[model samples]
Target: MFTTKDATTPHVGLLVDKVEDNVDYKKEDIKPLDKLTEVGFDIDPQTKNMMRGLIKLAEKHSVLIDPSAIFSPVHIAQEDIQESEAYGLF
Candidate 1:
C-alpha cells in the first residue's frame, strides 16, 4: 500500500492482483479493484512507531516479509495524514 497527498482527502492506495481483460473487466471495462475503497486501517502514531520497530527487527534478522503483505489500504484523518507526511512516513 502507498499513501498520496494529491487528493483533498487523505487515503491509501493498494496494489491488487493483475486483472485480465476477459475475466475481470466490469461493464465499462474497468478492473474490479480500480478506484475501489472498501475498508481502511487507521495507523496512529504509536502503531506506526511499532511497525517501524518491527521492520527494523526484521531487517536486523534478515527475515523481512514481502512488502505486499505488510499493510492494506488505510484512510487516516487529514490531520494525522499531515503529521505522517511531515515525517515522510508511510
Candidate 2:
C-alpha cells in the first residue's frame, strides 16, 4: 500500500501489488479514460473524485490518482476551512 498525506488533509493509502520508482511523466503521456476502459471497475464516489487521468508508464496504461482526491471524503469543520495564498496552488 502507498500512503500520502497533505497539510490540509488526512493521510490516505491504497493497497497495491507492487511498488516502483517515483518517476515523472510529461503531460502528453497521459490520456483520458474512455467509458470502455472504465468498465468493470467499481470505483467509490470518493475514489472517482480522486482520479486525475490515465497515464502510460512503461508499457502499461495506469490510472493516475491525484493526491487531493484521496481526501475528498473527509469532512472538515467550516471553521477549519481557511483561505490562504499558500493554498492557492492546489
Candidate 3:
C-alpha cells in the first residue's frame, strides 16, 4: 500500500474488524502502509478506484477518517513478483 511521493490521496483504506468485546484498540495496532511494504506488501492498483469511490462516499457523509487508517496491507504475490522482474518493474 505504498504511495509515490507526489500522491495527493490514498488509493486504499483499511477495514478492521473487531471480535472481542474487551479488546483494546490502539494507534499502534495500525501499522504504517509504507512499513508494510518492507515486510512484503505491495500496492494493488486494481483496488485504487474502488478505494477512491469509498473515500469519496465517506467524505460526502462527513465521516472523520484517521489519516493512518487510509491504507490497507496486501501481500505481494509470487506471480506478481515474477511478472515485475520479467518487465524490469521490480
Candidate 4:
C-alpha cells in the first residue's frame, strides 16, 4: 500500500473500520476509517489511472457486482483475507 518512491510523502496510509484493529498491518497499528479517509492517499497519478482502468474492466465484466454494496469496511477486509488465503497473498 506504500512505497519509498511515493511522491509528496513516501508513506502509505489508510483509514479502516474498528474491525481494522484485527488485521496485521506488518508495521503500524490500525486506525479508524475516518482517519484514513481524512488522511487519504497520494498515489502516483499513473497508478490511479491504471486502477481506474482495472476497475472499469471489473465493472464491465460484473467481476465486482454491486461493488458499492460490498464496499463496507468489513467486507473489504473479508475480500482481501479471502483472496489472500485462496491465493497465498499473505
Highest TM-score model number: 2
What pairs collide in candidate 1? none
Clashes of 2: 0
Model 1 residue 27 CA deviation in Å: 12
Question: TM-score for every candidate vs. truth?
Answer: 0.17, 0.49, 0.24, 0.17
Error of 3 at 11 (Å): 15
Ten contiguous residues with the weakest lDDT in model 3? 53-62
Per-residue lDDT over 51-80 for candidate 2, one digit per residue giving the tens place of the 0 to 100 score: 778777788666776644343335552235
* Best-performing candidate as measured by lDDT: 2
Off by over 4 Å in 4: 1-38, 53-90
| Cα deviation of 39, candidate 4, in Å | 3.6
3 against 4, candidate with superior TM-score = 3
Clashing pairs in 4: 15-36, 16-33
lDDT of 4 by residue, 1-90 (tens): 333333556543323222221322322232323342254645454333223111112223111122222223433544644333433321
Q: State each candidate's clash count.
A: 0, 0, 0, 2
> Candidates ranked by lDDT, best first?
2, 3, 1, 4
